[model samples]
Target: MGDWFQTIVDVQATPQEAETLAADVRSWLISSGIVSAEPTHCVLGADVGHPPGPRAETAVDPSGWSVPWHDGLAITVGRTVFDAGQGDPMAVTCPHCSTTTHLADERFELKYEVWEPFREVVRGWDEGDDIVIACPACTQPVEPTSWRWTDDYFVLAYLGFTFWNWPPLRPQFVDDLARHLADHRTVLLEGKL
Candidate 1:
């Protein structure tokens, strides 16, 4: 019978430092009379997207694994091996697209937190606009769907989200979470939509 809240903080820190910051924030919440919060259970490494840009790595054989670059290029796994008499660089399969084009890493890591809002008159809120939703699978824009309570907890959903990852911290993810919570709040708590 109360509104729920989820916050996502994206940071570039070591896992230990990140955990410390999360714990500190949680403690601060409790001290400030915010609802009790918990850190996400795990960290996930995933590729966000790759836009067309200047080439960063030479295309080489796909025999080895590819690595990501921040500028949207993936470095070939190994140095280019030229044929006995040719100068054309070898081609590799793009991991994200599977095309015969050169492949790159373009991957990043993210963390998620699930906070439970357990009381009436949820307070200390901010408006969310200019939110961006990107598909975890395709990295395309997605619409927010709904949120549901599950296993005595709340989870957010998007077009491609699963129970494995819920309550995405971005505005788009939050919108999806809000929709999920509204749709299944009754079912989650009462067994019916």
Candidate 2:
């Protein structure tokens, strides 16, 4: 079986505030015994991350397994494009008009004509550009990040916390974390690699 990961992304944090927020969150997590204070090579892509602490169980659902399986918390602080690891988003829904744009056809073939603009915007967003796309139906310009994706597939943000192979987190735990984040909006993305 492949590895699984769950990421909690701060959708509202600015690039300049990400590092500070990350530091604060790390401190809180450590003091709360959710993760260890010392960093180690416990994450997939990152060189080091905070391993699960003694009270790691407090963060996950009571019914789920509590064992520390693979890795730990990896905080990314920069303009980044966070997506589901393996598959592409099938469609995007415009926030303004509630219009849906399909990126793939009935046979799962990519619709290049519809997807090219979004692809470019995603690239620009990753590179720190404030790119916006015009909705085909509404003809209104909107931030790509504001559009809803299939299965909540993508998020453009400056801060994200990726937990590798951890149990499903508790909703209360996520809410508490968001509170520590100055009430910023967060998105939970889960995928397998």
Candidate 3:
């Protein structure tokens, strides 16, 4: 399991609009000092180009969706793109009952397939479809919110900012990003592998 967190902004724009939005996001990253045009003080001490290296799904240490759909328009911090399950992934507490459900526990193994749905459903979800996943602990139909139990197993989008091992995204950042992309739909995805 990997501790994966991504801030995905669904671009319903045409190709040109997408490019424009990407540029704006890049400018925001540079101006806000979140990232630098030139390598400043980062873990690797070098300007790691877009999409960096070593894909995350290869069952390797620190791999992710590093495809360079837009060359200079991706945000990846730290040497590792994402941390492995941040230790114990899928350990969620039922909001309705407050009962913690360990998804990885042998007892709840039944919900494994249910949680990880088909890739296309995930894509629809990323596009703003409301998907409810049941909690093994209380059997509550929970919707995805931050690190909640309905957290997406996969998301398909053209633009995403992945924070490796970072805590649930700060509200200010979410608000700011939402403000910037007012016309497009934005979804915060918490990934665990």
Show the lowest summed lDDT stretch of 10 residues, model 2.
61-70
lDDT per residue, candidate 1, 14-111, as tens digits?
33343444344334333443222322322122143122122212211223424332222111111111011212122222224333322122242111
Clashing pairs in 3: 1-85, 2-84, 2-85, 3-85, 56-63, 56-64
Q: If both were scored by TM-score, which would come out higher, candidate 2 or candidate 3? A: 2
lDDT of 2 by residue, 39-144 (tens): 9999888999999999988998647565547579999999888888987779988989999999999988889999999888888987778789799899999896
TM-score for model 1?
A: 0.19
Off by over 4 Å in 1: 1-5, 37-193
In order, the Cα lDDT scores of the candidates are: 0.24, 0.88, 0.45
Which residue pairs of candidate 2 clash? none
- Report clash pairs, candidate 1: 67-105, 68-105, 68-106, 74-104, 146-179, 146-180, 147-179, 147-180, 147-181
Number of clashes recorded per candidate: 9, 0, 6
Total colliding residue pairs, candidate 3: 6
lDDT by residue for model 3 over 1-193, one digit each (tens)? 3334444544343334555666676666566654455532222213543332222222122234353222222453211112223333455555577766554656534355534542223444555564566665666676543223334332334455544443345556666666666457666665554
- List the RMSD of every prediction in angstroms: 23.8, 1.7, 11.1
| Model 3 regions lying over 4 Å from their true place | 1-4, 11-16, 39-73, 76-107, 110-149
Evaluated with lDDT, which candidate comes out highest?
2
Q: Which candidate number has the best TM-score?
A: 2
lDDT of 2 at 31: 98
